[model samples]
Target: MTIRPLPDTLVNQIAAGEVVERPASVVKELVENALDAGGTRIDIDLEEGGVRLIRIRDNGGGMPGDELPLAVSRHATSKIASLDDLEGVATLGFRGEALPSIASVSRFSISSRRTDDDHGHVLEIDGGRVGDVVPTAHPEGTTVEVRDLFFNVPARRKFLRAERTELGHIEDWLRQLALARPDVELRVSHNGKVSRRWKGESDLLSGMRLHEALGEAFRDAALRVDHAAAGLRLHGWIAQPAYNRASTDQQYLFVNGRAVRDRSVAHAVRQAYADVLFHGRHPAYVLFLELDPRRVDVNVHPAKHEVRFRDVRLIHDFVYRTLHEALAGTRAGTPSGAGVMPADNGPAPSPASPGIGGMTSASGYMPQAPLGLQVAETRAGYAALYGGLPAQATHDASTVAGPPQALPDSGDATLPPLGYALAQLHGIYILAQTAEGLVVVDMHAAHERIGYEKLKCAHDGEGLRTQPLLVPSSLAVSEREADVAEREAATLAELGFEVTRSGPQSLALRSVPALLAHGDVEALLRDVLADLREHGESRRVAAARDELLATMACHGAVRANRRLTLPEMNALLREMEATERSGQCNHGRPTWARFSLPEIDRWFLRGR
Candidate 1:
């Protein structure tokens, strides 16, 4: 077979295969064009789920009569003119293929009139056949009407879902766009009945719109997050750990005002919520991450619902750290809301006054040097404050020594975030009263999170203590492995691994971190070398360190069924308030829950 150029109509039809998947796809393309035209108010009318007709009207800058024909021509776009313009495309719709592609598959008509013009020009196309441009009624904007989508291609039309299903897809996409652009008003009608309308909002993330989109539950349990650093800004509402969903429908993430579903961003979010949400439950959030346009590529997919960040790890860490810090105050409420999580390139927030839990640093539980393990100074300060005793003495006095005698003032505004513990229910739940109302806490889970944070601090604060192997374990390896061992000898030392190339294809491990948990040291070393060779960096050392700390915390934490005195319970509550990440246990289960007076009153049917 000889190769030949496909016809213009065929080319557009092929492009339509990508740009127009269903009626919803047509809705997306048209709305994007409206947004690019500087549309402020858009009204959409749908008939039979947009299959019979999709009429979109936008009050934006309209086009002249001469441009009406070009609007239906391929590769005719006003958004970009040069290669540099493509590099940082600020417009929502740049690809000129949308108009021509839709025209090739359906009966299409678009009309527009400039603000100064007395009349608008309209052009129609039926299955790639262009009609004469005619005068239309006056409107200082643009309106596009598409009828019988995929009518020329019966096979494609056959693939479309039911009417309601197609309309649902359109509604879902609109909601996502509304999240990023709260300034634009939107109106929708189905079968001539006005179905949905959202009044424009000036606030970046409007609580009213968010509640309308996500629900009042998500808004009630949301935390306002605003963090900006290193050319990246992440600000939005994140639902509390206790407020979650069975599915991931509520997680809406946008990069650079473009709604996108990225694995890197999603993974970062999942990791940030790792220890807070229950297993099988997904978090509800409407997070928006704003960064330089050049740093993200939004043209990766035809639908433009996914993006590729320039630096995956950098973006990932930014999103993860931002959300992680915002939710830290929920479990144990903040005192005056002073402490905040450190931004990507900044130091952690430190406490202004000395506290009961020895958490003097405002950065909460994060160590000054997580990688170097600098615990000696923290240990010394802790030792000196509570008398020169064992490090565990500063932990929980209730576990070893009996409960205290005299109680501190529990009345008025001086109570801790978790409030004063009134009693222990079933030796598991700690009942406390806060200014808000009643608070219930799981003793084991609360202690587990507290213990976990402290262990991580002490473990990271104290640099890894190297210990020589008693047997001096020897391992066989490849020639490349031997080279990596020699080249990364310093890196290994930094991670508490003292290894030297023993031969052309073997290595000798003589020392390891004393704090490192006992495991397959050889396997760990091999994995580290492999990671170093692949990514020029390794997470094995950090993962191993965290595993060890988690284990230690699990063992040291207060176990359930252990009786506690009133003073001990209150002391634990104070510690929780001062500690970061105390809202959820090590496993992401909520440690405490607030029950307002209204809820208690409702239960008792007060004033009924």
Candidate 2:
């Protein structure tokens, strides 16, 4: 057989295979077209979970009668006309293939009337067969009807899931659109019965939309994030660390208003939460990253669900640093409105002010001596239990001591976030009182976080320690990996690695981070190289160091079943309030929980 150009219909059917995977795919394309047309309100009607019929009506700028035929033609798009236009596309639908591709696989009709037109016009297509355009009556907008999706292609039709499953996919896509475009109003009906409606919101960052989409709990736990720098802006809501999920179903990322999945940004978020999140838990977030269109390519995927960033390392670092700083305020006792934990009803207490000897006036308990003396008294006891104070403890024990002062009154406005410790519960938990109500703290968990933060500070101050290997280890890798290792040698050195390329596809690892010297050196190098090649940076070394430090802190922390006096407990509470990311322990478990007075009253029926 001789090679020949594929016929128009055949060519269209082939393209349909990529653009029309299922009914949900059809919805995505059409809805995106509506959004690009400046549609403020959209109505979606579906039957048989959009498998039998899908009609989308949008009150947007509509095309003229003459443009109807061309609108359904392949490669005929008004979104872009040249390579430069494609490079910096801002609209959602630019390929122009979505309309024709979708038309070829299903029975489709489009009716539209521009605001200035005397009448509307309609065009129809049946299984790749185009029909003549005819006059019709329509409102000042566009309405697209797609019927019997995949009817002409039995093989493709067979692959579609059950009605409920297909509808679920469509609903999920709509939810994503709703999040990205809160300004657009959307209404949906299934089999003639209304299913959902999202009213248009004037405020793009309205919490009502978040509550409607994710539920009340996430809305309440949401932390507003808005920061701009270096030609990039990231704004959205992130669930507090304590409100984590078991899966990543709630993670939503949009780049320049288009919903997409970017591994680098996702990894940055994960790293930001590494110090506070539980080992197996995932955080929930709805984030939008905005950068110059030239800096990102959205044409990478046919479905437009992925993008290629020009500077992966810059994006990663920016996201990581921004979120890292934001989460640092998760220190225990922050006001509810401050994005940490929610405060209970009543006047929000003022943040604790620095008091004598580095203690806060809000602690409400006066120690008998300087904080340093207290640590010295407990140093011998801790040494007897855990061998000796770690280097971090030794450093802190020397500097934290200051002259003691009188405690504040219980009703003072500057009450510490955790309040003054009332007593120890079973030697494991600290019971305290606040203006709001009760606060129960897991002593061991709280101390572990406190110690872990101190250890990190000490380690950072001293800089990363490198351990030289007596015999350099040789690592065989791909040529690309070797090239990346060589190019990123400076970055590697900053991460406590001393690697040099010995051959075209090999590396000589002379040293590793001192903290991870006992672990797998070659494997670690390979992982770091992989990250560098893909993300232009690597956090493997830092993650490993943090894990080791976490273990040491856990061992050094105060254990359960140990009694504590009011002053000792109060000191611990003050330290928690001052420490970063102290709301949770090193392992991500929340160190304390607040039980507001209203909730306690309901539990005991005190008001009744």
Candidate 3:
């Protein structure tokens, strides 16, 4: 082995491997440098996903003439002056390799001048070689022009995606940066035309405006979270329960004004949302965490995309608690147009009028709140509101009562026709005869599955059945649960649930789905409400619907342990044969597995 310095070209290419993974990476670095230099306005232009050209200009403090060349050299100065600075990184461009790495593999040119300077100088580097340092006229700031990215690396170029997809990546990165620095104006152009632009403005309203421009469904459901404790301040907007996407692309996270991904921060969010949302559904949030820079480490990666928190547990707990509180207060008010679940019946309470230290009735139906939210005063409030009431009053008046007065069959021709027939099982399962197979069915599972599908379709805007609450029942929940409920309101309404706040921490129960025949409305409400609290907003609706079906199926299905007559069994078998997808039950479990005569004989050891 020889220990010698590598060739300049080879070294540059190797560095490029880390700094330039895709067009988005280049944009991220350039834009970040602009921001670090105190740029309040930036413009980005791209062509063919940066394969042909990429240009970034920023109105920031620019480099002086003598410093132009060092800007493109590996491990150069600025950003970090000492090892101690590494311990508490605040800037986004500490690793000085980005410029050189990008320059080595592409045609790079930079024109920069200090804000006070009268004119800027242009410097060009082609394939890692300095071509010239000529004087040029330009506005105050810096502009870096990149052409033919990955030109010398054919293999890397081959990995580049289609132009549209590459552009999507670039757009996504720009949006993230825009979210982090809402105070900075950003303009992006691709293929010589303006594609995306954001005139950075402070405040949640401005952020929402940017979200609308991005067209990522960021505006559907948004929650404002602002809390401060023990030297850490958490502020940002979370998606309402009714607003959620099918992917993680909508989530924008920032820590101390720098956009970096920290698992601890994400986990805190997820944990806070646990039990309020459905599995596999993520909540959309643009959360900003502000704390002393000394409490975190940002020098973990060359790209500066991740960080390490000094007190991870504390951070997690703080975020979880803060969001949980904010959601609780917000959920107590009337749901917004975004389709948040209406508060249970009770006196309305807003974050501005948080009840002193008592868990509301809504809390009874939700997952346990964080210790911070379980204030003594809140507990007393919960006791005063619901403690002495009879069990039936606190639960549901409908349990002792019966179904809502069914109107005489309405002569409405618009209602679709439904065929109904039932064959009894060995006292448990039901066999329903249908055009398909005999439709041997698990009565409970089938009903539950049907209910879920129906609810989902309705929530998707295909159909809906709203059940109004006769008496609004107040529901008390942790802030996170409340948030989830708000996000999934439309979906819940589709399932025939009309939730509204009846009192502080109390949601009134006015109506329930007609299909959910005879069940404990109070219990069902508890389960549905709790699901929203655990999962994020996106999952909240699905969770509630699933729970409803689960309860329906449980009560409606045939009991497995019960015996049946021969006729009943035969009828059940016939119904099973007639059902669609009869092989599987609701919850995706197989309903039944058949054995042929030959298999039965084999089991008896009668095989010749």
**What is the TM-score of candidate 2?**
0.91
Give the range of the ten consecutive residues with the poorest summed lDDT in model 1. Answer: 367-376
The list of candidate 2 runs beyond 4 A from truth reads 204-207, 337-411
- Quote the RMSD, in angstroms, for model 3: 19.5
How well does candidate 1 match the true structure, expressed as C-alpha RMSD? 6.5
lDDT of 3 by residue, 333-394 (tens): 12332323233333222222221122222222211121111111112232221122111112
Candidate 2's residue-wise lDDT over 1-608, tens digit each?
Answer: 99999999889999998888999999999999999888999999999999999999999999999999999999999999999999999999898999899999899999999999999999999988999999999998899999999898999999999999999999999999999988999999999999999999976455377778887788777777888999999988888898999999999999999999999999999989998898899999999999999999999998888999998999999999988877877778766432333332222112222321235433344443332212111223322222323332222423333344354575788676778777788889999888788889998898788767766665665566788999998989999989999999999999888999999989999988876788887888889989988888788988887887778778767778865556667777777776778789989999999998899999999979
Clash number for candidate 3: 89
Give the residue spans of candidate 1 off by over 4 A.
204-207, 334-411, 464-517, 520-544
The number of the candidate with the highest TM-score is 2
By lDDT, who's the top model here?
2
- Candidate 3: where are CA atoms >4 Å away? 213-217, 330-333, 337-608
By TM-score: ranked, best first: 2, 1, 3
**Weakest lDDT window of 10 consecutive positions for candidate 2:** 373-382
